[model samples]
Target: MQYFLVSNDPDRRARWHDRLKAAGLNVTGEYDPSAVIVTIGGDGTILYAARNYLEPRILPVRAGSSKGNRAAFDVDQLVETLQALEDGHAESSSRTFSTLTAEADGKELEGGFQALNEISLHHSSPVLAATFAARIEDDTTWEFPELIGDGVLVATPFGSTGYFTAITGETFTDGFGVAFNNIHTPADTPEMVLCSESVVVEVELLSTKRSSGAVLTRDDDDTPYELSEGETITIRAGDRTVELLDVI
Candidate 1:
């Protein structure tokens, strides 16, 4: 089968190139427009590739790790996995998918990508609160919404094991597509709904200039937006879903 490898290791890259060639399969270092993507690094590489290629080709080989992110599978095992696929000894199953779109103030992010993990928004000051607004994808109850808290975030079941676990104090199976909300901080004052499955959310600066904050980060987007007194951020699962070449 046609495959593409994305890695920075000169020696390993060369080694794989030679090995794959001898195996009678075509491989390339650059993103092959018509080939399956094979990320050769750790989880960071997987996440990077996931965003770069989206669904389809963006799969991983677990070369190594960076910042505790893992490809879910390891390299040594990956060697066997790739070989199995090449030998037609194994196949992949299906996995659920979700999309995260980030809009700050009132505009959508023009760059970066939707997060596979959780979407987090924080108010810059500890002494102040930022009002997070939201709209459920197709909910008719609340046309415009708000969540008063120090900050707010939406996490999926796949992401339930990551940042979501850090806040909600709970863990869930990856097979479930859901969201978590945490509003127990001091700045949130009393409290807000700890969790909800609403598909849409809008975040904004509620208080006056009493606090200064900028940017709403999704996955890892660095693009920043200035918040007016009523500026808001809206987040909803996108129409597209990522498909993983399930191996386990």
Candidate 2:
């Protein structure tokens, strides 16, 4: 079977290249539209693979984490899993993916904004809290006072198990539609309640220092944000949904 193999670690890359080859499968460094993508690593690596390797193509992800920040699943048995794919055991897999959209200034941000988890707005720098009006799609905007801590985040059920759980957002079951959780501020909580599917939210920085206190990010994070107070950040559910292999 043809598969898309992606691994940033040179050592792991070489190891898997040899291993998968020995397993009797055709592997390509680049994503082949016709090939299933197998991300070899932890969930984070899987996320990275889905984003950078097969983002536009949007294929079902067969992922496992080796280890890192966390290993939601196991990696020791990946070889067995690989064998399953080769044996046609992965064909019955199915999973749903979630995404977020953000627009700064006027132009839309590009590349890797889609998050399988939640989209968050946090402090750009150590300064005043991120304060702005948040409105769900099709709703009017409501303003908030200066923020005290970092910022707020919105996560889906897939993401609910991640940061949202740590922050006390309720765990959202998968395949029940999208979830909005991990809200830090009181106003933001009510704001999300009013949110709808694919709702558009605008966060306007109220701090005048151009404190750039707030920035928007998708699931994987690590994006460059140059926003200041009064600069608006527009966030909404994305049209692109991820397809995860394996129901669980």
Candidate 3:
């Protein structure tokens, strides 16, 4: 089977390359959509692969001191695990995870604004909290007229274990999770919701503070979309899903 090894460390990749070659596995120099991605790092490595290669099956291998939530095997076990798959002695199951898509003022962002984790809209300023109105349109509608806070986020089940957990101190099994970030006003505070994946979240920038506006962040992307006042942003589950190759 065709496979690719991904790593940020060049030395590690070189060593892994030698190991794989010794074990009789060829590493593709170029990314092949059909090839299984073998990432040699932590959760960040896996997430990076997940975002860049949407359709490839990922084999996350933990290495060094990296903490990987989705790593399937350690570095020492990688060769053996992969051999098992090749010999049909073991199998890899696909675990599908949902993704996020966002739009600004009804127009989809560039490159479709797809994310594997959560989408956030927050105050761009450092000291002041932004005011925004959030509405969850689903089976049962819920709305907060004016939320004065750092910002808000919409997270998928896979994302619930990340920032959503840090903010709400909870993780959910299914559906999208919503968290209110550092709300200044106690009144009209909206509780965190773990609603269906079909739910649509709308955030209206209402902050009137000087130079105040919201920045929309997708996953851990460094570049975020600017959300001006009076503009609305929508977050929803994307149709595309990520498949991880789980060794079993």
lDDT of each: 0.57, 0.57, 0.84
Which RMSD values do the candidates have, in order?
4.4, 4.4, 1.8
Q: Count the backbone clashes (under 3 Å) in each candidate.
A: 6, 13, 0
lDDT of 1 at 116: 69
| Most lDDT-accurate candidate | 3
Candidate 2 lDDT over residue span 83-105, tens digit each:
77567765444556656666775
Tens-digit per-residue lDDT, 1-248, candidate 1: 67777665667767776777776776776666567766667555555555666454455566644443435466566556767877779876656556566665445666543776667766766666556554444333333245555566666565666766676666665332223244543334321223344456655555554547634665644554455666666776654466555465
What's the C-alpha lDDT at position 128 in model 3? 77
Best by TM-score: 3
Off by over 4 Å in 1: 8-18, 65-72, 104-107, 111-113, 125-149, 172-198, 208-211, 222-226
TM-score of each: 0.73, 0.75, 0.92
In model 3, state the lDDT of residue 195: 90
Worst 10 residues of 2 by lDDT: 56-65
35-55: candidate 3 lDDT, tens digit per residue: 889999987787778778766
Q: Which stretches of candidate 3 lie over 4 Å from their true place?
A: 186-188
- Residue 247, candidate 2: alpha-carbon lDDT: 18
